[model samples]
Target chain A: MNVVGRRTLTVIALVALAIVGALTAEWWLSQSPDRPFGHTQAGHVLGWAGLLLMLLVLAYPFRKRHTPGQRWSKSLFQVHIVGGLVGHLLILLHAGAHLHALIPVLAMLAMGLVVVSGIVGQVLHALAFRTMNEQRRLLLHQGLPEPEVEARLQALAKQEETFRLWQVIHGPLTVTFVALAMLHIGGALYYGGF
Target chain B: MTWPPPFSMYPVLLTATLVLIIGLGWASARDPESFWAPGDLSVHHAGRMSCTQCHEPFRGATTANCIACHADATFISQPDSPPQIFHRQAARERARCLTCHTEHRGTTARITTDPLNPHSEFIFRVTGTQSCRDCHAGVQKPGPKYGLLNNDAVRRLVAKGKGAHGPGRFADCFRCHAGGRTGAERGS
Candidate 1:
């Protein structure tokens, strides 16, 4: 499939997965009136596992900046995407339908925002990268001088920089989510006695 | 110009979320119940809004904190109730107040019962039975009485031997057994 078609399919699949997950959680909670599974030992284990996976997602950005190879960056990106989505699903399960606490509810909202913003950033980045590569190939085919082609690519890069503006929102949302998550954990520990 | 303009609503929305999160944190620090409490405290405990009143740093609402206020024998000792006896005996060693009475479930919430699941240990430890049906087998019909009232341990402690109030005599154990000192009072 073409780039646009592939991208569209990816976005649709992600949205569909999110919707299905949400509906499943709702159905599971509705199965029981007390909905006490979130407080069970199994629920807590799921929460801890999800939290660890989400924390691992941060390694992608760190590795991307430090690793001097494209291959490793690509693999880490995949890990970041998969780990984030799966971690989010586990967290949603751990949360169940217990929406009584304000701090935890806020943390969930922040987490959702972070995931949405990250998905948006991922799509835009993919599009920009593909467009830049295609433009570079076209410039080469046109028999432009190396220096001239380089200059044109630099200009294209500048234009593509607009796509990165999603990071401005994504970065802060991530920090907010982390902070709220920490507070939620601390509160649980303080009040849970376990 | 791209799908997302340089100035989009994304930034505005992000700013609002940040502001709300920060405001919530600040408010919670000042009064945790406003934004941190899972639910409202039961009506009896409503006046004690401070989390630290029952909660100790890193320890949660310990049985010590609970017994601090509820030192009365009425709250601790009920020989007829195996759960109460177990809790009173093991308050320091094994049982926690939160095991049975969980708060922050909204005012009027039943804090006495385990809202999540029945305490399986009660049946296992008190009745020495695995399933509820083992003890409540004939509860449906007028066959044989079951449960803790007929348990040997309870019978021995309540109305069988010397120093035990005879059966059908003391309807209220506390009437004569007042001030029998709790485990907490003994500093055990």
Candidate 2:
């Protein structure tokens, strides 16, 4: 498929996931009493599932470093991205609309920032290819030899490396989110909640 | 062209994250009593600054702590006195007060955590074509004062009527059959 079509599909999928999260939250709030979200069975399920998915997302870096026999790195990377998104969705549900407590709110904020930064990084990487292709075609038309054209493309690629700065934001935010999640879970246990 | 991180940013990010986590842990440990509270307590319990008021140090809140304040005569003297009679019944059955009266819910949270059928408060089990409203009409009478039609106030009214109706009359039927079932000797 074309680059624009692929980007559109990604956007649509993200939007769909967001809608699902919204509807689920609305239904949960409407159907249940205004109790603490973390205390309910549904909240517990969401919390555990989100935690599991987040741990699975951490596996991506390791998987990318290896050939891993039959499984492909590209597929694993896609799973990582999607798993992080859905995991954050579950965490949002676990928090519910009433973010009354300070610690939990901070944790949720960190998680949200991490997910947003990761999405921006993904978009930049996907769209960078189209920009590179256009530049390469233009250089070739200008009668540059194949080797010179390749060299110019390398320079352009180097310029686009600015997007890698997203990792600085994404990585720290991920750590903060994980730390806060641990705190939240521990606090829950200490307070005699599951 | 500046190539983003240039391989030096990773260390900086890692260090910052480590510092933040350490700071958070330090802050948390500074107060051994600190933990994420579930939510706000009820208005009457607003003065309770610590979990120890309701919860035990580590073993968690017991029914004994609940009975300490709740079973006080002054507290029970209040109009909305929390059905301590029912609580006594629950205690006899070894039921925890927390089962029904969950705290930290919210300011206006109705303390009944579980569905408490009012009929459960009766001495005799309400069965066989009986509904709660049949005996307890005006139970939720909404004005300022307790309406004279239902509840213990009505029980008092029945006791007075028994004396006026000249002893051993039908006050017992007044419980189930209501005021209409009683005839002219009914206390005005």
Candidate 3:
């Protein structure tokens, strides 16, 4: 078999393991002859992965070692944003969309806020990327902060002048998102499972 | 056919539940489409595994995985440590992974930590605060042993209170706490 066929079989095996894991979880749930213990393990797999995945995605880019002026920055950030958004979707599913529990609710809210902030930061980051590119394209002074100057040097694309602003704004928003994410997890610890 | 209660059925029940769950999960895995969006890439990433990786598995399809991750955390019980502990066993009677997690339901469940125990307070007051009473009573021995707390006020402080300067606000602290920073309701 070719590489593709080999990879396909591996994927199939993983699926099989996942099914076994699920069934194992179900059995664990059923073990509580009197208390419904086994009954619950049946449903916890995805939520765990979702919460962790979102945090991992959010932290990956800035956590990576990269030069500020590198070309890969834009692509890296786009990946970060997409990963974060997808992770959040998984987390919501993991929680079963229930936040009635005070601690869990607060945690979920904090997580939600972090994701929203991440979204805003992604937009700002994109804007910054565009601005930096324009600054590069026009051969303007990297130190120069004026859009008009950048415009005059080039064809004066409206997009050119606004890039620096995005760069400046994204920094603070990303920091806030990180801080909120910590609080969300910490608060979840405080409230606990009943 | 042992009764599934207390300690007797622990092993059998656990095993049986495991088998049943394996079967159900196996059946669910046969289909790739049930796990995600039409052609979701993550499903492929998961190798077609069901959504139980991070979640807690219960009887059928519950998903409360929070407790599994946060069980050992002190935040689940009390904010501050008490002078006495009632539940001295330390997670002895706490809920199982599934009881607290119960998954696939929703993220909004009312997550709550167990409260601190009350008996520890009762035990602490009786032993610690009264430690000096033995020597300070002056009638027992000569008093000069290791010298930890003020043995002089032996008879008075226990009856009244003992603070840095002198005397405490709450009169019957030992009546509640039980012992010195140790008792039944330790982490409540």
Candidate 4:
């Protein structure tokens, strides 16, 4: 067996398994009963862990830049996509499909915004990735040097279909996520605060 | 062989125990995990040393008695239960503080606190929130035509329209319509 290939697969597997673990914890703990301070706190912790994982998925480019030492990383994109989707699933389990009507409705709006943007981001990101892949294939056919190919991929990453639209949506998306997050926190404070 | 009750009675016994559990929780004033969370309405003041201790009956719950407990003269005991908040409510309708201030009943305060509880009995007719969609169905979206979308969120959204952008009136219909005096304060 190719140890390096196996290790790459192992990393992806671990990330996916962690997502499932978070989801399981979320489900188990939400059913445990909600209290000001109780076992359900574990569920809150897991939910946030899932969100952090999703954010890592969002920050795919930064990771690639920083980790130049590991070139044969074997497609972190797949891991990123799978990890982000798993977080969404786990988040659902954490909330336990029950919430006060007002705050939950507002929360649903924020989540829906995230889901829509994520879908758009995924499609554009996929399309751009595919195009880049095709360009690399064509260059190989034309006998382009490895350096030239690497330069091309870097250039494309800077500006492409998904990244271009992302430039517009990325900031608003951040603002909305952060703003709605503050509102979510405010609601928690209002409900559970002194 | 029989140390206790029969097995056949288990279902009935379980139901009885559950009802007892809820009753105890209710009496004790705490949240319940017994699947009936909302049904758990602990009395706000059942252990009150006396209604008269806190509630000063006026020339039969006169406004003075309201001010007595509701004002700063007495360090307001329960922040949630304030009179001036409802004083203007009582004053505008020429209503006695005792009207909504019925003290003996358990969880009577729920009329104000519980959003689903109806306000039909009160002179303050409208549910502090909305009353229409109580049953009429599907009036909420494509955005409440005559103005049901005026809930707090919508109102804040509309406030945004008003503050930064010029007026359009459609941003938050819920603030005005759901609020008391349909077209008065929030209709702006």
Best by DockQ: 1
Note each model's CA RMSD in angstroms: 12.3, 11.4, 23.3, 22.7
Score residue B119 of candidate 3 by CA lDDT. Answer: 20
Model 3, range B1-188, lDDT digits (tens) per residue?
A: 11114477679857976785576457435752232211222212245334444422223222234335444454446432321122223345553543332223222211211222222223234445432233223222222232324454444534443332223322333343332332323432
lDDT of 1 at A167: 64
TM-score of each: 0.65, 0.63, 0.31, 0.37
lDDT of 2 by residue, A10-75 (tens): 876875679577647745664544356666776788889999999899888566445444454777
For every model in order, the fraction of real contacts preserved is: 0.45, 0.19, 0.00, 0.00
Ranking by TM-score: 1, 2, 4, 3
lDDT tens digits by residue: candidate 4, A1-194: 55444654575576557556754655565442122111145556656775677677755545665785566344777766676567665665555444433334445456546655665566565566677888999988899998999898888776554466564665455445545555454434343231
Q: Model 4 - which docking category?
A: incorrect
lDDT of 4 by residue, B1-188 (tens): 12133598779868986796567546434421222121222255444433234333222224455555555433333332223334444455666544343332123233232222232222133233333343223332333343344355445544553453224444333343442233435334
DockQ of 4: 0.02
Which of the CAPRI classes, incorrect, acceptable, medium or high, describes model 2? incorrect
Among all candidates shown, the one with the greatest TM-score: 1
The local lDDT score (0 to 100) that residue A20 gets in candidate 4 is 66
Stronger candidate by DockQ (2 vs 4): 2
- For candidate 4 chain A, which ten residues in a row score worst on lDDT? A30-39
| Clashing pairs for predicted structure model 4, backbone only | B58-B61, B149-B174, B150-B173, B150-B174, B150-B175, B151-B174
